[model samples]
Target: MRERYEFEGKRFLVLGLAKSGYAAADLLHSLGADVVVNDSSPETGSKEVTALREKGITVICGGHPENILDKGFDTIVKNPGIPYHNPVLKQAVQKGIPIWTEVELSYLISEAPIIAITGSNGKTTTTTLLYHILNIGGKQPLIAGNIGTVACTVAQNAKPDEVIVMEVSSFQLAGTESFRPKIAVWTNLYDAHLDYHGTSEEYALAKAKVTDNQTEEDFFIYNADQHEMLPYIERSAAMKIPFSLQGKKAEGISADDEMIYWQGEPFVKRSIIKLLGQHNLENILAATASAILMDCDKETIENVLSSFTGVRHRMQFVKELKGRTFYNDSKATNTLATKSALSSFQSPVVLIAGGLDRGHSFEELRPYMGRVKAVLALGETAERLVDFAATCGVPLAVKVRSMEEAVQEAYGVSVEGDQILLSPACASWDQYPNFEERGDAFIEAVIKL
Candidate 1:
């Protein structure tokens, strides 16, 4: 790990004690910074807190003390999920104290060039795919950020010869200042996390930060199909590499129904790709473009694309039991994502959906319900989704109380050639802690069947 002397003697405040917060605090403390970690959760006796305290860092828990900011800290390394509207953070802004997410720290200490991926959806899939391609192509890539591992933790031990592939979120990007990636990929943009960002424009701006500090020497691979991303593309200093599913463009990556082309040259046959959905094609194009920029050969990219079934919980093919294939798309926590998942299959689909109702209408989903043979709804939005499914002329709509019940109901409605997909068009918080847990439950239930 490269030694960073800049943090030495600095007084740093880490807000919120999640994975990112812990990693940032530990790294900062190790670099000679006087770190004070604060978590709104009341669990002061937690092992994470105890460990930080053991490292000579102050641990504040239970709540945000109003006077904590009065301590005159030089900078604040915030957990991405912690809103800027938090009382402590609002005060920090008023005081002109600079704040950063752990990713900024990752960039500061890392000897390797970073490849950051961000989007409203498909960040994980693209990050994972690019990492796979790079790894197979002998690029020695280290995966981190929102894909699971903390970015700072990965960067801590990253070597100069290696590359860091990070799946960054808007929450993380919003807190970054100089966290430029050598190659950045914006999979696609959509209305998401408005509660955290407060506005769509703000959310887009946050995602744009992936390329904010990138130079002409760097590469920005983005969705040319998303017109909303054009403004940000124009503002970026990086060399633009556009990927489109529409058709073969003048340059960059483009795909037809049969082939994926690189700068108008046929790179790979689309029929060989195991990943489902046209949305995934966009992800493929973005990742392929990134791998090319990383010097990965066409053969390596094709090999990875052909073998990668899908990212787990994101339109992942679970199994084909008695010829009724099941897919777990628990990551489809919004209408746009669910629509994409629904469009992936040609066979009749027994879709198990519904979760936390954020007051968004299911009307946006109506147009895509044609192939849906049956609907097994669950969680807070169950009845609402069933009612909506009825309006869409879906033959069978059942309200299921649990994931197991939903899976069983889906199987009951599905035939041998049909697909049973768990692509909840709402957040999992109403029934489970997060999407992963909800997806795991669905998978376990599927295995039982």
Candidate 2:
């Protein structure tokens, strides 16, 4: 077991007693710290609270006392879901209380090196790939962060010998203060979560914070091709390990068809990469580059990548329905990701798009109208997308009420070798509970067809 630090009678309060919070509470208690666990929803976090309380941890569910912070807790570790605008966090700031997210807390207790990854889309896939590559290369890696397990929880359970591979999201990035990783891999960035952050600039800044805390000793890994990240790349204090799929080969790595190569080092990786699209290849390049930076040998990196397949809800090839391949890419929740998915195929695509509008411009997607045979729009953003595609001179553009109607129509129109892709370029909250639900529905409907 990992050694819990001796808090020396310091008071530690854990807000949002979810899985991460329970782990935080236990670790704090083991260190002889006075720990208080608070969860606003007992029903949501009920079982977790009971388990923690069974271990002698103080857990208060249902509501947080207004004067709780007045007790002078030395630190408050907040769950990532709690926004920056939360009253608890606001009060903590006002009272000058040291508040940390689980990620921030992980950075404190972590002895092993951390490889942190963040981006608008491919971070989850990249993180999982890197974890596999590192382990195959003889480095034990603990996979955690936004993809599954929480960071501090992983840290408390982690053996000191492993490398921590974290799939960090922009929301998690926003709440962290000093969560510095040894290797910060920024896959890419784009306008997302404008609803919470209020602006694209704020969202970018929050995503950039994954590297904001890095020191001169740390290394910053970035995609040089992303124009969004290029303008802000110079701001990083860490030594840059840049990777690019386009342009000149840099100090890090680059990949052409035959090889995944560094500046001068060449490795003809046996890559029968199953994942489609240039974006996925870029994801592979980024993950492979990260592996090399972490001291993974070229052979191990290549081997792990060759054997690996894509993740669920991203771009899983569902099945062939009426001669058309149905691809469930319900994870493409924004225009950039959807654009990548759409551009992946040279075939005539019947694109099932539209979802909640995040105030992004659909003007750039007009160029893709020719490649897409028909645009079957659905979700709340359907009408707006239909209007935009019409302006682009697409005669086959049509709007439908739901995913089922859209899928059936798309299947009807698609010929042999054509593809039906569910890559919604907008948020999923408009119709479904989330993107996963939307993607699942797409798969279910297509399978029946």
Per-residue CA lDDT of model 2 for 77-103, tens digit only, reads 888777768787889889888777778
| Model 2: residue 148 alpha-carbon error in angstroms | 1.5
Whose TM-score is greatest here? 1
lDDT of 1 at 424: 94
Per-candidate local distance difference test: 0.92, 0.81
Per-prediction tally of clashes = 0, 0
Q: Which regions of candidate 2 deviate over 4 angstroms? A: 1-8, 42-45, 199-201, 213-217, 227-232, 256-259, 269-271
lDDT, residue 196, candidate 2? 75
In candidate 2 the C-alpha lDDT for residue 145 amounts to: 88
TM-score of each: 0.99, 0.90
lDDT of 1: 0.92
